[model samples]
Target: MAPSVLIVGAGPAGLILAIILRQNGIAVRIIDKEPTYRPGSRGSGIQPRTLELYDILGVLPAIREVGEFVPPMARYEPGKIEPTSTARLGEWVDPTPDVPYSNALSLSQDEHEEILRTHLQTLSCSVELGSELRKFEHFSDRVVAHIFKTDSDGNEVEETTTFGWLVGTDGAHSVVRKQLGLSFLGETRTEQQIALGDIIVEEGVKLNLWHMWSVPPKLIALRSGGATSKKFMFAYTGRPEHIADKTITRDEFIQDFYAITGRHDVKFGPTSWLSNYRPNLRMVDKMRDGRVLIAGDAAHCHSPTGGQGLNSSVQDAANLGWKLALVQKGLAAPALLDSYGEERLRVIAQMLQLTTDLFHKTFASLHSADKSDDSGWKRGGDLAMLGVNYCGSSIIQEEPDAVAGSAYMEAEGGRVQAGYRAPDAPGLIHSGTPTTLFTIFNTASHTVLLFGGDLEAVGKFPQGAVRVVEVLPQGHSVGALAGSALVAEDREGHAYTGYKLQSDGFTVVMVRPDGVVGAVAHDTEGVERYFQKIFI
Candidate 1:
């Protein structure tokens, strides 16, 4: 019998989860309360890490076709632009050409979701929009869900299904979270924010960089869309009266825009979508109970300071999706699922802390008086994107040669530590395909990184279960000759640095499907032991 998984919410998290599960041969059914896709530009920036993940999922090109790259820029005040943080777009994709997407692309959330949906449609799994889950009953063996849906004519109907597990990828106000009786414990910032619609900007005003204006009572952000469209997000200190009425006129929006930009000659065009949102820094106490799990905003919601919410959600789905698929197929033990909460919770907590700090810094800049020391503000802004780290989790290994263990010490933790995504190595190859370590390493159920040794000894494992690659000396490694590769030479003359082997023999580092280090062993004898411990 095939195991079935139920996912609530059709947003990015849910949709991406469905695609991954389906790709892994798992049966998935996704439900969403909304009848149709939401319009307008909600989040317009996709980080470099996300682009890397999309490449692994084989959808990077599709996303890039509709997306734009945002050149980094610093804005001290409205219309006052300062040149800062700039990278050759896509350089981070692989640090090598054989890899897919190496750069961050800017596209509206609507376009991103549409591309994901199109990919999902190619699979057997699909999202059931307009269908809302009324309640769920968890049994010892199976979980039953009651779904209430409204038809095209607005007729109500009910349906029921049983599944092996249920995942909540719904937004912050997730009904799935509500039904589970989970406590969302955190503080909601007292400030209110208004993120306006996707509108066209007048010609001659450059829309290539993100325009930020630090003004009292509000910090306004103008984000450029792919090619032509433009959108603005306004974070105001006080809650305006009648904001909940949803009847804000275009004239009022224009006035606010002018006040933020301090430019009266600017004209506003039609808005495609408009909404007021109160930023909340919150996370559920637990991400899983019994056979139920949660992802995305349903489990955690943070300020849009680092633009990490969507990326974090997608990553959560990526982690849980493959595990659920393997468990359903009886390829791994149920204990593997426990690592999900243990691993993701650590990440969520870190993101919350970083985002909270970002909120304070961004808002503080907004409230500061003229000529105030902007050094602190500038440092905070720069650190926002480089502050995420995943350490001290069940899945990541504590490598001896690992760098500082603190989350703040490095962005996303040092690649060699536990709970961290293995860093890319330049000029690595797999199956005659020219690619980086990330491309070869990310294609398996678990990643087995062999530092420096012959591959024959480690080739006994199940095919495709682990990826085996050789990290050669700098001058000898293929990356050196590949011209485009970013391979580095350390004191040992190795093609890479930062990873430590526990022993001289075949050291096997098993990275969980979610990109976390699951277990480590120095010899083949430790394989069964590691498996037994994780299989339950």
Candidate 2:
């Protein structure tokens, strides 16, 4: 049987979107043009917000076991083995009840994709490798896709299939986007180029630190711990055309590395992967075109300076998965899918600007006379992505006369407002069992958190669409609650503190499947009003 959804590209974005859709019982098929899984340490930084999403998807445990915190950076002079400055990449923040994973994690991109593919297997779905999307025709109700692949007998095969929808998670050179004719408007930074790859380093080189060298003609940086402890991810600026064009031999590449770093004592084994990276600050004009949609690198591509590319791409898939599931299941109107583009375009725009600014700051500091300027290295604040929101999205709702502030920026004075990330609250008692907000939230349904509300008076919304959880203050009786709603007593007051519930009145916080606070209503009627915009 043909799948209901066809996802082109089996990268992190495509794999994650398939997982979310499959979890919601949607039929999906993911394909990649490559014959085998790609290898490299591309976009290796995982932010805190991404960790929260992974927890919801049940992949956090494996990621936590294999991933390590971002290592501190060690700067060195041209030929000096020691006697240099060392500092952390970003200030470390201790975890709190609201933000359990506050620090960024370092794991290779290939390993990351492998973990995601492994998780997808448990769901009875897997990427169809060696299959490529040749062309696709989009109609109002369905899409016809032409696929090209080699059969088991080594003969080439061409097949035609149909799907309810098509999504492109293919990288920057997206055939789907080009076929859709969406304007990819942005500039290419010809001046900024670097050679990135994964290589096995010789013994005697420390594997716990990220080493940086400001050699005369080029800047070389090596990040330790790739697919193995012996491997390192290396990046060198001042790209030569020969290297970019892949005309440089392996010996010449090694010679250039030794020349730039002046470290002949450290030797490197055969490289596993190599590519020339030129920053492209570009974004598509729209994310959707009728029955077809584009996401990740297809919709937007930016510099890798702040490590926002992969994280943003993962979140984009998360945001679209639930919405598309609803539409495919007939649980909501087709217009609900439109919100995917609406919500993500804003966040992607802000991210492109943020990353571009960081890119310029980093290169400026490196070229300037002041070698001690570490301000560009500092990452936190908005870079953590905990502050990214969708308050301006048309689907989000708040009380009348409420000011709908900007999206992706921290609220004034740390206030949790509508359309912000639903903060996690620990130390809750659920009918004599310990629970937390994150444990209750899943990728399948909306989690309606009622704080200090009368269970009987709360009007009925769509039961199939939401899970009602009534939260009471500490010391309150969490005894058998009325109706199907689960009762949770805030044993440590973290629920109220994390959400900033200063008022003692009943408050309803509707958390979307993607973990964004869709609405903060004062009454049950307001909650239904918000649902009206989503459900048919």
Listed in order, each prediction's TM-score against the native is 0.82, 0.96
Worst 10 residues of 1 by lDDT: 480-489
Native-to-model Cα distance after best TM-score fit, residue 463 in candidate 2, in Å: 3.7
Count of backbone clashes for each model? 8, 0
TM-score for candidate 1, please give it: 0.82
Q: Tens digits of per-residue lDDT for model 2 on 1-536?
A: 55899999999899999999999989899999898999887888999999999998999899988899988888887788882888887999999998999999999889999999999999999999989998999999899999999877877899899999999999899999999989999999876677788888886468888888875337788898743588788887875655554433456667887887678988888888877777899998788988899889998999898889999999999999999988988888888888888888888888999999998887776776767778777787678899888866789885465565445576555555677889899999987889888888988888888887554534455556678888888888865556646888999999999998953778888899999888888776788788888888
Error of 1 at 280 (Å): 1.0
Instruction: Give per-residue CA lDDT, model 1, range 1-536, as digits (tens).
Output: 34388888988899888888877777788888888878877876676667766766778779878887655444545654343233221223343332233445667888889899889889866677888887999876788999899988889999888899989888898877898899999987544555455566664345666555556666555566644555543333333545633544566666776766666655566777666667788998788787888999999988876677888898888878877776776767776787778767776877788778866776765666753444323322222233344556554455555553445444332334454544544444433444555554453366665544433444454444555444554444334222111222322422244444322345555665555555555665555455454443
Instruction: Please give the lDDT score at residue 362 for candidate 2.
Output: 78
Off by over 4 Å in 1: 1-3, 72-104, 230-247, 259-262, 371-390, 397-404, 407-415, 429-432, 442-444, 451-464, 467-507
